[model samples]
Target: MFIPYCISLYIIKGNKSIYDPAFRLFALNMGFADLEFMALVGIFPAVSYFLPFPVSFNVCKVFGAFSADAWFTCIMLSQMMSLNRFVGIFWPGNAKAIYTKRNTTITLAFCWIQGLIWTSFYLKPNVGLYFDSKNRGLIYDFRLNGTETVFSLNMIFNYVHASSLCLTYGLIYLKIRQDITEPYRLTIFHHFIPVHDKKDVSYEDNILEYKEIMAAPDLNTGWRRKHMLDPKLANDRKKENKVLIQACVICLLHVAAVATWAVSQKIATAKYVLFIPSIVGLFSSGSTGYLYILVNSTVRQKFASMVSKCWCHKANQLSNYEARKKDSGIQSISPKKDNEYSELMEMDDYENVTKN
Candidate 1:
């Protein structure tokens, strides 16, 4: 958790130009969510569960409140990421204006503030989180009058996020497919027999043009993702596609974890079985860092550089410490030898005086 968080922070901070402005904002927020989830919710609670002493209810409540906040933040960010991809793909012309730095900044602020407001409900005495010893997990208690509304709202939010991801990704897939096939389909409508082809020599050329268009490689495996009309637009589209692919993989993991938790809640299961959902949720949160490192070449390179620097720094420190120790030992031994030499000279002087 710590390593990935650092790597992600480095990528976000050091490699700003690696992604779009909106994408950078989204990635930054997602990093914060992961940090909060891992620090406030994941590591502490997991460690607490294994301790010799039992954790107090109030402490559990506080932890659970923060956990819920992190969870909700992630859900909200996931939806925003989906929307960002959707707009970039469907409206490439206006994506730049729509997702300006100022706009993304405002959106991120709203997301965090919204999370805080939702988390306030969990702070109430009747509505907070508690650990269920039987289930060995943190269980939200929302049956009380005060918490029932919050519970419903949370459920509704989850459903909305899940639904948006599904709809947006579905459309995105269709749009990409359409783009790949449109060129070939349009080739059939072209004038197969040109007027100049009356010479018969040009007839062969027209046939070849039609065939060439038809034989164009599938965009899925082709070097170019789209039949780009302009080089700049093509580059932007390619970047958007890469961003979409990474975001989709991350969001899919989130959706799968949420779905698993929902199903686990519905089933009446054994005591230990309840732990599965929570475990899966943590896994989902933790896995994003690994995914980022694996998928983004820039991030991977930066992480490697950081690791190498740290090791080199440690090695240098160790060498310096050893050199200092050796110098001190030699200094101490030299003073002792000089004192012994002086004593031996005085003894030899005494023997010469006695002989005279």
Candidate 2:
């Protein structure tokens, strides 16, 4: 999961020409948050369980705080992405002005700050969050031994995030349905939103260049931004649909994991039952990177290209090392052969002299 997530990030960042700045900003934040969440919340506690010594409560609390912060940031960013897609589809004309780099950066900063503030509430000595190895999940320590307060707060956050995601996606679906008059609803949409004048449908102004220029070279070398005049040839529209699907898939997976956690917290009394939610949560976090690669064709191609390059590089290095080793062996043997031949020649000369 870590490797895949990192690879996805690398591909996205390395190929700026392939991704819009707004989308790239959101993706980078989400990827970083997931990596942190998985490490601090999932891996650290899991590894601690097998350690020779018992992990102190304070240590768990510290890690859990950081994990909670990352978890909140991821949730917010996911919601933001849902909104971003909604805007891109519903308000194609205005999306360009709305999601400029400056606005997106500020929005990301707000999410991080909000996450920090929320996490601070859990850090109080009376009310704390910590990973419990014995219990196999995050434990909320509330004053008077009542965890209902923190649980309610967390649930509210999830409900808002989940509900907003549904609303945005629902609206997006409706908009697409309205535009797409064909019997096959699943057909790829040629135009996402309808514009009175085709001239108003400025594909260049909306999202960053989403599709690879079919006429251009492969992304391995590099790429130049190319815009299409014809709606059918406009790769942005096709890519927009793809992004929508990708975001929807990620939201569904995330909702499922969060739902599992909520249910486990309320009714799960058995330790084994509690463990299920943690595993689900980890899978949800780890799956996002693979999901990106799976859903986005550009990302998939980029990742494949990167892997192929690395493999070829390693193979070349191995071949070069072997060639050098073989040359050294030949050189060493040639000197010994030369010495033996010289001795033989000297002996021949000595025998000839004796015969004379």
Candidate 3:
């Protein structure tokens, strides 16, 4: 789901579908991070569950270290999302300046590297991980060791991050409310002087196209999303709010899921919540793509179009084969026709069939 949505978001232009290119990129990166966390944390557990691989404690530690990298990256990504929203709302003028492609790339790269740095702290004396039958996955346990301080500090770091995120969004919410009560406007004008001769000159006034960061609201719901007089402006506001709302919901779910997982780790009484621990990060990474598909109408149309095209292609192939048989009085074609993508995907299957 993440893979297809990521591809479609890029190929179909999601910002045009809803928000801007920056949010589209944000969603894409989040999906990629989810895939990263999934690969690091899910694969070994799944493989062990099915085949019972005798992985040594040292090997498990190595895998756990990689998963730790994903953990830290996720933490940093949450902070980035909060900051992105803050800038987009509070300092709309500087949103583009701050959320540039280069800056975003550099920020993500730094977070990943930071994850590696943070993962080092997790490499302690008594921490051990192993595949278990009870959970049907890896179980992480810490024996009597003085390294508990490091884990405690790590938890502190997460708390600080969460607090910062909440603070930023809270500020953004306040700003939104203020804009509703007190409307603000920005304007720009240009004056040009044209000289036809040395003694004669003409002055002309020009008005350049300008867009306000916040449009005035006539008065609406509890707060005020955007008061619309013109159809175009109304549509634009609706699109922006759709992306913002989806992002907010996804972020909230991600944090809640992670929080539950973290709590389950320390609280032995709620051990059944272990499932939440395993799936929260995975869900966080993949949730945005699903939200876009379900909520963003443009993305849905594109996805539906793609699906229809695929079915039509398959139907065409069957119809062509039938036509050939009818015209030539034959039963079948020597070889079936398939698109290049299909052929590439089926190459391994073809080889296996031949070997069988």
Candidate 4:
């Protein structure tokens, strides 16, 4: 929730032109999904842990419903983000036309509706879905106990969540590999160019020149040159690639964790391997916001400015209270003139004058 809230603020305050509508929608979805997941799954599990109050079977069912909805929405939005990146990279020209704000918004609305539809399956009085035996017991056994099929709706939701995450990470891996390899090919081609007098030519200088030539292209040619040739572009690409790789790693971890838990359950084990992975997955979901902070110079500046403002505000409040105390003779003024205090007072005065 903090991640997407910060990201959304950055988008709204910063460059509107560069902000993709799909990315904004993804962020919004992520915020809500994280809130729902934390509230339904994380908080409830913690509640069941500490509270002596008998856990209500119906409450457990509600938690399942919320978890299913939240997990589905998260996966759906994540897949959309992956597709958005794919469109931006592979079809930059058509991306604007294809992923307009209205269209993306509609798509996200559909995703939520779809999640709600799936979630409705557990809304009944006798959904009778107890995730684990330790937290929930035979108290949950109800009318739907024997009637419920082995392949329940909740099971389908879990499968979808795992599969979507796996698919998203697989696509991201392929995309990064393609981007990385393309640059390598350009670098290799530059190496093969023959130099007569390698001394005057300065093989290093030749490579640099080749990189520059490939960095940016003329408007006449539609092809975008690989960044590997140009050191600057290559560095930028490396940074972006790192973000994508981090996202992929997080997705892979989620998949692995969920798969292990599913396997354990199928083997009639009591182990809950999903717990660690789910927590880690939630933490990893912040990668998109972190990526924004990493890539966008504007966002970094805004974040710095916000932090500075908060500190300054607190300092001003503290100074005002101190001044009031001194005037009232409630607090003794220090005998020694501290340089730092004097500097801070001067700075505060300057800021006050500017504000006025």
Candidate 5:
């Protein structure tokens, strides 16, 4: 999921994705943070686990702290993205004025810096390490009892982060309700929000990039500025609708994924199943990259195109080597031509490496 999605991300950006530039770049940041975190915790540990000797406890603590930092980064970026969407939709005008390219870049950098700073406090003493005799390497307990206070503080921080996310998205939902002409009834067998009705209407909407909401009446103060965007496109009509669906999907998955952890924490002697949530959470983290594909059809198609081209090219290359050789040479013979062909082949090889 990480490799393909990341490669496809580059390809899509190279070709100019159908999504907004801000959103595209934000998604890339999310992928990078997630990939780093997954590698630190998942692949790095797996490699150490197979080594013939245990690594130093200090080294273990360093990696664990880095992992925490990366994970924290991922959470913060998600919140940033959610906020971007919220402001874009709820206050589009101000969004354009505030979320400029420079600001976004700074925000991305800040997320990483702040995340590392947050984790640094607990890196020194808040860990325990043990040699896994069977695995022939060290395993770490990142949350030492001595630092339970710090751990509790971190948990509170996470809760605050989660709360901010919910609040922003909730406001977006409420704004959507305010904009819609008809008061549609919401039904939930799972027992959620209440229902309402007004006038029946189609799903079509003139969704502004959501960035051009009325500029607040503080022109003299030079408050948030507004950028004029192109006229609404065909997809603009259902912009909020799409966001609504995406938000609900993320919220639902998050609730389900975290439930196991909540339950596991309750039992003093919970069986091996207590570990199941950790496993589930790991797999889910690895898979978060793929969620972009599921939610964005444009991304999905781009990925499919990339995968198909690689498969077809490989199959064709394998089936008729002579033909491929001839085909490769047919495009060039002179030195200049040869150089051009070489460059193209180099690019193709580079792309293939990234895809794999």
Candidate 6:
């Protein structure tokens, strides 16, 4: 929730309208879903464990149900974000037409509704908790009995999610690689072109005109200019390349972690062993947020500006309170003469006006 709030607030404060609306909405949804999942699965369980509260197994089931649902939704949204980027890069011409704010809002709503439906069906009220034949107390009954069913469902979801992510990353990497390779190819072609001995002033003028036209800004402002300039385009491509590489690395780590956890769970191994991988997977999800921060300079500058503004506002408030308190103290200590009080009031007014 905090992450989403910070990111969304930063976006709003920046007044940037360039990014795909769908991507932004999806990111906000992701933050909210993560916060819900953490609260339902992590915090509540920890509190129940430490506090001497008469916890009901039903409560645990409900928490587990919601957590599972929220997490599934979160993964789905992550996939959507990847798809959004895929469209932005591969189909740049149609991006604005396809990824409107309304479409994104509707997609997010659909994701949540689907999650709710799935989770509600699997909830304890709908499906009774199952107990293990051996070591009954070792695991929650819901988890034990529903293991196969949940695993089957999760396997399908995981396969789809992971496949989509891999494909998106692959496409993005290929597109960027092609973009980077093109300039070199053009340079090679330019060098290979035979130099005619005939004086062709018209050809030189045409080449200069082409360069000037390419230098001119388009609707996307500097983005068009930067795209035309190989060096600038290379820098932008490098940043994207770094983000994609990191995302791919994290995605692999996530796959490994999930596989480890699933195997551990199936073998009835130590829960802590499963926990290590789960924690890693959770942190891996944070990569998406970090990628958003890295990709957009507006977001980076906005985040910094928000922090600065918050600190400045706080400092100003503190200073004003201190000044008020000091003035009150001084007035209280001085003789109760109207003239002195008026003089102090005038001095305060002068100070205020000067400060302004």
Highest TM-score scorer: 1
Off-target runs (Cα >4 Å) in candidate 4 are 1-18, 130-133, 136-243, 267-281, 284-301, 304-356
How do the predictions measure up, each by TM-score?
Answer: 0.73, 0.73, 0.67, 0.60, 0.65, 0.65
Give the runs in model 1 whose Cα sits over 4 Å from its true position: 50-52, 184-208, 211-238, 265-269, 311-356
Per-prediction backbone clash count: 0, 0, 0, 1, 7, 0
Candidate 2's C-alpha runs over 4 A off are: 142-146, 182-234, 313-356
Query: The CA-based lDDT of model 5 is what?
Result: 0.58
Q: How accurate is candidate 1 locally (lDDT)?
A: 0.69
Clashing pairs in 4: 211-229
TM-score of 3: 0.67
TM-score of 5: 0.65
* lDDT agreement with native, every candidate: 0.69, 0.72, 0.59, 0.58, 0.58, 0.58
Q: Give the Å shift of residue 265 in candidate 6.
A: 1.9
Tens-digit lDDT string for candidate 4 (1-356): 45454654555444543345676667557667866766666566767867887567667777777676776677777677767766776777898999987898898998898788767765755565444436221112335754254235445656776787677667766766786666664554445443345557777776665555455444222123455234455545654565466456656655654564445434333345445444554554444465555555545555555565577687774344455676787755653323344345445644553344
Candidate 4 Cα deviation (angstroms), residue 213: 9.9
Report the C-alpha lDDT of model 1 over 138-218, residue by residue, as the tens digit: 665645566656666777788778778888888998897776677534534243324253565665687776566557644
Q: Go through the candidates in order and give the C-alpha RMSD of each one to the true structure.
A: 19.8, 18.8, 13.3, 11.8, 14.3, 13.2
State how far residue 199 of model 6 sits from its true place (Å).
9.5
Kindly report which residue pairs in candidate 6 clash with one another: none
* Strongest candidate by lDDT: 2
Off by over 4 Å in 3: 1-21, 123-133, 144-147, 184-227, 268-273, 314-356
Give the per-residue Cα lDDT of candidate 1 at 209: 61
User: By summed lDDT, which 10 consecutive residues of candidate 4 come out lowest?
Assistant: 133-142
